[model samples]
Target: MAFVIEKPTLKDIAQMRALVSDEVKRGVILERSEEEMANAIRSYHIVRDGGEIVGFCALYVYSSSLGELRSLIVKESHRGRGIASALIESIKIEARDLGLEEVLVLTYRERLFQKLGFVIIDKTLLPNHKIWADCIKCKHFPICDEIALIAKI
Candidate 1:
């Protein structure tokens, strides 16, 4: 069956939250509340396979010129099916449509981002304070090892 990519809606909150929670448990992604996802539902893109949410991602616009890719997660059974890439492309299109000049991502999967045309950069180089606000929730806030990468659109 073909997967469908579309923006999330209120009804998707439970599934979205569960998917994120599962990822967090696996230590592969950060945790986000259902309320948070509901409020930011417009910024998310999800992949559904047979009506089940198998992949998810969000594009956070911090400024007119800057955006961040956050909470990219694909179901373990759905990896290697191009769902993640599809979600990333959807975010990139939204970023470009919003007139963003650059997009940043903090990810352990450097090679994946690199292959997608993202270049590694120093985390300190990002001057957005709001972006760092989320860092406080991270266990490794003071010593994050996730590589920061940017792709100019």
Candidate 2:
């Protein structure tokens, strides 16, 4: 199957919300508001097959030297078909093109990121002021178990 991966537009927000909301319900990801997704639509990339969205990811740039990969989700039926890998590669390319020095990710899927050249790192070693804003509101806040990984772009 072929998948087209590209930045999202306002019209794609609804489908993106549905995929994300499903992942939230499955407890595989955090909940995100459609309004917020739409507002940051430029940061998102999606995989579509025959005009149907099957996956989505976002690269959150904090500075020219720093970017974070977030909101990676693939439809249940489409998992393990390399959709996630493709999305990650796309973000890496975008990060490099934007002159980002590195890209970081906080995720439970440690092995997946590792296979993509990301190495486990001390979260504190990175400047993540913006991450804390979202972290504070997370249910797993103080005891967050997600692993932090970074890949030099």
Candidate 3:
């Protein structure tokens, strides 16, 4: 099967929301409202298998020097097909094009990120703004179990 990775269109909002909502319910990702997804649509990359969205990822820039890789998910039927890896690669290219120095991720899939050249890092090393802006809103706030990782662009 051929999978195409590209920026999402406004028309993709509904499918994107549905996919994200599924992951959120499974506790695999945070819940993002439709408005939030629509507002930040430019930051996302999606993989389409024919007409269906099979995977999704987003890059949230913190500064010229840093970006956070967020909301990576692949449809369960498409797992192990390297769709997630391709989505991450797409995010990296976008980050490099934006002149970002590094990409960060707080992930439960440490080994997968590490395989893609991300290294484990102390979560405290991340910027304070990230903590205040997003982490604090996370349900796992004070006891976040997600491991932090970074990959230089």
lDDT of 1 by residue, 82-111 (tens): 888888888888999999999999999898
- lDDT digits (tens) for residues 49-110 of candidate 2: 77889998999988879999988998889999999999999999999999999999988999
lDDT of each: 0.85, 0.86, 0.89
* Top-scoring candidate (TM-score): 3
Better of 1 and 3 by lDDT: 3
Q: For candidate 3, what is the TM-score? A: 0.94
Better of 2 and 3 by lDDT: 3
TM-score of candidate 2 relative to the true fold: 0.92
**Model 1 per-residue lDDT at 75:** 86
Model 1 Cα displacement at 33 (Å)?
A: 1.3
Candidate 3 clashing pairs, residues 3+ apart or interchain? none
Q: For model 1, state the Cα shift of residue 123 in Å.
A: 0.9
Q: How close to the true structure is residue 58 of candidate 3, measured as C-alpha lDDT? A: 94
Q: Report lDDT (Cα) of residue 99, candidate 3.
A: 97
